[model samples]
Target: MRVTLYLRCRGIAPGTVDLVSTGLKTDHRGILVFTLPDNHPETLRLGTNDLTALNPEGRVPILLLPDGRKMTQSGPIIDLIESTLAPDDDITLLPTDPWIRAEVQRIMWIIAADTQPYQNIPFIIQAMGEWGMVKDNPTRHPLRLHFIRREFGAIENLLTRCAGKFAVGDSVTLADCFLVPQIRNALLAEIDLPSEFPILSTVWNNLLDVPAIRAVLDDAGGIVQPLVYDAEQFEVYNG
Candidate 1:
C-alpha cells in the first residue's frame, strides 16, 4: 500500500519537509509534493490538505485502505518515517556512541525546541493575538519586531556555537534542516539576515551552499517566505 503524508512547508506547524522528504529524496516516501514549485509559488505549503478522521489524539485510530474502508490507525507519518530508516538505523535505549549521540541530541533539542518550537508556535501566536489587537489604524505594533528579534538572537547563538557549514555534527542530521528554515523565518519576520547576528550570518551564508538543502528546494513546491523576505524589515526584526 502507498503511504500518504501531510506536509506544511511553512510556519511553526513548521514542517521541516527535510525529514519527511527523506522518503521522497531516497525514494522512501511514496508521496509527492501536491503542487510543483513553479505552479505553486508558496514557500511553505501551509494548508489543510490532509485531515485524517482517526487522529492519534482521538484514542481510536482509523486506517484507510486502498479499497476505501477505514480502520483506525492514525499514526501514519511516524510509521512512514520509521519505515524509511536504513538497516543500521535501529531503536535502542542507548546508542553505541552514547556521548556523541548525547551531544547530537542536545543540539537537536535546542534547535528543535529552543531554536524554534514550531509545534507550540500556535499557542504563542494565539496568545499574541489575544494580547494584542489589529485594527485599520495600526495593523501591527513595532514591538513585535523586538520580540521576534530576541527569538532570532537565541537561534543565532545556537547556530554560532555550531558555526560550521551546517548545524550539529560534521554530517547533516535533523538539526540543519530546521536551522535553515528558522533562519528563513527570521528573515520573513523582517529579521536581519547578517548584521544583527554575524555568527548566524556566517552559518547561514554557509548553509546556502549545502547540497541537500538545495536539492530539497529543487523539489520543494510553492512560494517560500525566504525568497520574498524584505531586507529592511528583516534587519529591523533581526537587528
Candidate 2:
C-alpha cells in the first residue's frame, strides 16, 4: 500500500520532514506533499489553540496506509517505518545497541519536544493575533530564539559525546533526522549556527549528501529559506 503523508511546507515542521524522508530512504511506499492554502482544517487537523483536546498525538504529517488505516504524529510514524523494514535492509536510522538508541532519543527529543515548537509560525502568529499584538512585533521573535538557543546548548553538550559523521557515532540515526530540520530553522531565523555551534554546523553540512536527506530537501526546494511575514521584512512562511 502506498502511504500518503500530509506535511507543512511554510514553517518549521522539521520532524515531519525528517521521518518522511527517512521513510523514503528506507524504501517505504509513500507520497509526501504539503498542506497548501494554510490552516485549512482538513489538513491542519489539530485545532489552533487546543491540540491536546483534539488529538494529543498531534495533527500534521498525516499518513494514510493502503489498508485505509490513518496515522498521525511523527514519532509513531517513524516507529512504523522502522518496524516494517526487512531483515536485510541496510538503512537503519536507529542504533541496535540499547545505550546508543537511548542517547539518540535524548538528542532527538531536545529538538522535537523542546526546541521546535517555539518557532512554529502558525501558532506564533495565531497567538499574536489573539493577544491583539501586531504580527510584526519585534518582541515575538526573540522569545522563541531564547528557548531555541537554550535547547541547542543542551544538544551541543549531548552531541559532544556521540556525534561523529552524524548525530550519533558516525551513523545517521533518529537523532540526525530531528537535528537537521531544527538547524534549518535556526538558519532561517538567522541564528548564526556557524558561530554559535560549529560542531552542529559540521554535522549538518555532512548530512546534505545523504541520499534520503538530500532528496526530501531537494523536493522542498533546497535548504528552507525563511518565509517572510509582517511588513518588517523578517523572513518566514505563509501560515
Candidate 3:
C-alpha cells in the first residue's frame, strides 16, 4: 500500500524527514505530498489553534495511508512506520540489536523530546506570542538559537560515545533520521556547520548519500541544499 506524506517545505518538522527516510530505507511504499507552509495567509485564516481529530494539534508530518487512515505527530508516526512498514530484514531503519536499539532510542529522545520541542516553529511562535512577542521579533530568534545550541551541545557529547558513520552505528538509524533535519535547521539559523560539531557534520554528509534521504531533502528544500528551495516561497518562519 502506497502512503502519502503531508509535510512542510521547511525543516521545521524534522520528524517528517525521519518518517519519510525510515520508510524509504525499509522499502516501505510511499509518495511525497507537500503541505501548505504554516506561514501562508490562507493557513493563518484557518486559525492556527483549531485542530481536528484528523489533524490533532493542527500539525503537519501527517501520513495518509491507502486505507484512508491519517497518521499525525512525528513520534507515533515513526513508531507506526517502523513496526508496520519495515521489513524484517537487515536494512530496517531501527536497529535489531538490543543494545544498539536502546542507543538509537536514547538519541531519538534527545532529539525528539529535548531538542525539537524547544525550537519547533509553531510552538515557539505560539509561546512567544503569548508572552507579548510576535513572529519575526528579535528576541524570539535568539531564544530559539539558545535552545538549539544547548541541544546540539548535548548531542555532540552523546555522539562521541555512540556515533560511527551515523549516530548509532555504521548504518542510518532512527537517530540519524531525527538528527539530520535538526542539523539542517541549525544551518539555517547560522549555526556554523561542520565547524561547530565535526562528527555530526560527517554523519549528516554521509546520510545524504542515501537516495531516499537525499530525495526528501530535495523535496523539502532543507537548508543543506539551497538550490532545491524556491527563493520567494520558503521563508524561515522560526528564525
Q: How close is every model to the real structure, measured as TM-score?
A: 0.48, 0.69, 0.67
Candidate 3, 1-239: lDDT as tens digits: 01121122112235433343211110111112234445544335565423343375544666666566778767677677555533546566667789889998888788778877787554455554456554553223777788888888888888899999888778777787778777877776678768888888888888778666676677666545232123222233223
Lowest lDDT sum, 10 consecutive residues, model 1, at 22-31
* TM-score of candidate 3 versus the correct structure, residues matched by position: 0.67
Measured by TM-score, how close is model 1 to the native structure?
Answer: 0.48
> Ranking by lDDT, best first?
3, 2, 1
What is the lDDT, from 0 to 100, of the residue 103 in candidate 3?
Answer: 91
**Candidate 2 residue lDDT tens string, 57-151:** 43456555656566666778767755654543245566778999899889877877887777765455555545654455332366567877898
Model 1, range 106-146, lDDT digits (tens) per residue?
65455445544432332233333345533111112234454
Query: Candidate 2 regions off by >4 Å?
Result: 1-58, 132-140, 226-239
In terms of lDDT, the best-performing candidate is: 3
Q: Which has the greatest TM-score?
A: 2
Q: Which should have the higher lDDT, number 2 or number 3?
A: 3
Task: Give the C-alpha miss distance for residue 55 in model 3, angstroms.
Answer: 1.6
How high is the CA lDDT of each candidate model? 0.40, 0.59, 0.60
RMSD of each: 11.9, 9.8, 10.1
Candidate 3 has its poorest 10 consecutive residues by lDDT at: 22-31
